[model samples]
Target: MSAPCDNQTGGPERPSFVTDDELERALRDAFARRVATPRPLAADPAGLAVRRARRVGRRRTLTGLALAGVATALVTTGVAQLGAPAGRDGTPIVVLGDPRGSSPSPLPAESTAAAPAAGPVRPELDLIVGSWLYTNGGERWELTGVSTVERAQRVPDRGGWLLTSAVTAAGRTLWWVPPNGRPPQVLLAGADAIAVAADGRRVAWRDGGEVFAAGAVAGQLLATTRAAAPAGAVPVGFAGDTVLIRQPGRGGFRVWHSPTEDRLGTVNRDVLNVYGVRPDGLVVGQVSAGTPRRPCLALLDPARELAPVRTGCDPELATDGRGDVSADGRWLLVNGARNAALLVDLDALGSGGSGQSAGPALTGVVTWTRAGAALHVDAAGALVRVRPEEVTAGEQPFSSPVDGVAPGDRPVVVADSRP
Candidate 1:
């Protein structure tokens, strides 16, 4: 849970939450306090140095022990089998840390898991209507097939989706559901997290505490390249050819060029969590900085050390990393206070206008369609399309129900859905 908003900053304060590192430290200190007796092993300077090194190693071992205990507790309670819950408004929630505490070692490059048997492909598709994939009560649903995929992202050019299995003791399987509908091919196994480029031409994933990148060509992954990353790093999204890796429990992110494996440096110190990246390279995230530490939705320039290009501050607004920017980077869908979903106009916000005061908040997860309309799930789990003019005029934007799709399913539209 987030801390109370500070009036001095005119926005929400940075969430005061505990981190894994802090928890480990507390556990170590408590264990030390119970040591009952101290052995005198450091009378000489050299002996003291050896003792200090041993203590450090012991702390490291204790961290691993603590994480193992956490994993055991989760499995015992069946929490590990549960998927992340959607927000009250239907926005998907983003959790930062791996349940196992640290990333698993990376699998061999040739170690691809066997692909599942392919289903029959549809004869034709309406690209204009687009496609969306989401999981409903443990079933992964797409227009052409259904499976047990826990998370999915659209591969626009490939006409399919990239899928990841639910967390397991071994790790998650990364699969590619082809447009031709042959079957889903396994791209990699034992992956911790995955991120695809905006164009669907490139892909990146984290495994074994390292970040790997590869080109997505003709429904197949090209040769893979690996780069070392900081501890607890996970690939969040891509900025052009650069991969943006978020450091769990830390306020900043690392920008690394995929092809060259160059560490561009860290960014977004004031931004707590990133939602999405704009086409022009501006990062959309929750910023909590400036005098008095105001929290708000901000556009941060990655090249400028994450300086705010524009800020939309609202005292009542709160985000759990459950929002996204439109294809044109003009509209933003974010979950507002009281579970209200808001459609924010970036152009207006840049022109000295306010998003919270400009339009009424609706109830559902709102996303942008290819035709520039707002497609959302209503309270009854129905699909509703809203025109751009209706959003600007503060009028009721419900247009019609989307046909042939089940209700109560979250929809993921392509990001660049500009007219």
Candidate 2:
């Protein structure tokens, strides 16, 4: 298969979330460093570097540990697997990473796994790739090929990529919030609210006004809920078994925790929507109860609601349930901009009250942090860099720190990376 043409050398084995100019500068520095070193070390330093690089590069290539950021490397392996179906032409599908790679030997558009009994067996929906949209009735299906320019829906309740769309999947037309909005079982009525994770299995969205969820399983009621009972304020997404509901009081907006299936909540009237969440009770969202429309997000440690991590901006709850949002970085405690926010001038924030940024704002940021490990994502929700404060000396179970691992789509295996 034809491979991507990346001639960059030196610097960190992998590129971090640096601006293109920064990357270019880094590459230049690497080149200068190579030039500065005495006569290519022993024989030819360039050749030696390639040998060393190939070793580490091959390791990164094999592991595929990084989150989805850009399409730089995604084209290497799966290009062969991207041939046109019976009817469609072989239009090169632009994945999460950059499309500068060489044309790949297309593969039969069939999944290595058994084809779903209902439809074509996709290897798996790359959260960064197009999604399988379903209708409320589940009768028709459509593919809104994913792109970076499109606007993204966001919701705080979910902890992943916010994949919001009005498309249909299978035979059903569904309105999803984020993450994987078009699952067979979910129906995010009212304003769309959904979020898909980097792993794909953990889908979160609003259903009938209340939060609900389903695993990547084709047809399973992961979690279900009614909007709100007694005409209480509607609920949004789900934080594990707890639902993020809007409370009712004077100008109320709160996160009233209820059983996974509970549609109602005790009136707290302090929280906004569950904008973003993580397995570790780190929940963030807007606080609107007292503030009303001027809502600000609060990051809650779910275990302790009163003292959640509060930010100065509002996080949108995406239709796909992925914690994809316009993390109004204008404020000190910024999350991330909406997936589509990338389309905006990276400097728009700076000139305006938003925030001043150099180059593409998305170019230099990390979206998620766990333990001591950090993964950086670009405008397209691809994981471009992995910064592990301490790289394990030997080969541990590490994954490649590349582009295109959108948040929420959790990799099933242990994520090992070349530190």
Candidate 3:
């Protein structure tokens, strides 16, 4: 797709965007280090370099032992399936980690399995190939036919999903691929910062700093309320009815919620990144290394109900761009340097965060769904699913990961069949 901001006479248009190739390498190196590095046996290491090398070799053996232990202890004893019940308000209830050994309950038996029949057969994975969006399945539809896909999301409503994207040419346009086997339809133009609600019925985006909401299936304009966001605030997501936005950092980073459009509070400027803000007002982001502080993952409950929790960050932790948090708000899929993912359990925030061996490393956007699935595009451009339990296991299984179409097919959106 031709970029709009290019200089006709000389230089290249648009700043450098990282390619999928670079991301794959980074993910491989990061995962290898996290899976194998051993804790120092001695309090002091005056001359144990050789022993450390040997310890590294033992990591593969240790991984096998760890997996065996998990089968015996975690699987047999029934460690909870990593979930929490919903709060009184319908948002998932988030409790602080016990640190004393108690853990949250496992997901209900039904959720631990594939999502109910009401959910989609599979979640769709989308990739940006110039301006067009192709589906690995389905009669491939080129969203714009003539424009580029700037951003896209699968509508969350289980009744059926609408694949929404911002198609850009001279100006940005909004469009949706309906579930009824119809061709892609244009919703509007000149929109940016588009986000779809969990139910996939509502779509929101920014136009000249004004945020607008519209019906994805009904084809109706919902609202165009003026936002009080600070200069340069961009609409990022929708948690239930609340719209989450990120503001550029001046001293401390800030995330503002709309309708109310109030700042989601943070403890300090050291909290330099915003991965996501939950419908319940929980903010997950990174705390940059600063004076008297080491880099860490910070979970800020803006309601002031819980103490702000910060766990020391891994030197390899990658907190670039934004990431996908699970529907229950307990699991988050993070992409580190080189397209590697760090799977974080929100309930374990006070403890050091956990890592996942996201097989083959993700090369594109990673997203989570209410169906308990984590989806992403791998380095080969193939769409894949990595189950939560598989991720928590922390080792590459001997078996192949969940299979899907390979790279170069178009994008797919996994959403429920439209009623």
lDDT of 2 by residue, 80-171 (tens): 22221122232212122212332223323322333224422121122222333222122223333332212222223332223433423321
Instruction: Report the alpha-carbon TM-score of model 1 versus the true structure.
Output: 0.57
Worst 10-residue stretch by lDDT in candidate 3? 90-99
Instruction: For candidate 3, write residues 86-132 as lDDT tens digits.
Output: 22122111112211232123322121222212212333443334333
lDDT of the structure predicted as candidate 1: 0.56
Model 1: residue 216 alpha-carbon error in angstroms: 1.0
TM-score, each model?
Answer: 0.57, 0.34, 0.54
Q: Quantify all predictions' global Cα lDDT against the true fold.
A: 0.56, 0.35, 0.49
How many clashing residue pairs, candidate 1? 5
TM-score: which candidate is best? 1
Q: After superposition, how far is residue 9 of candidate 2 from its true place, in Å?
A: 86
Candidate 2 off by > 4 Å: 1-191, 195-218, 227-236, 246-253, 256-261, 267-269, 272-275, 285-359, 362-419
Candidate 1, 250-276: lDDT as tens digits: 556667776775454665567676666
- Stretches > 4 Å off in candidate 1: 1-146, 156-159, 165-170, 262-264, 314-316, 350-352, 356-367, 376-381, 384-386, 397-419
Candidate 1: residue 165 lDDT (0-100): 57
Span of ten consecutive residues with least summed lDDT in model 2: 410-419
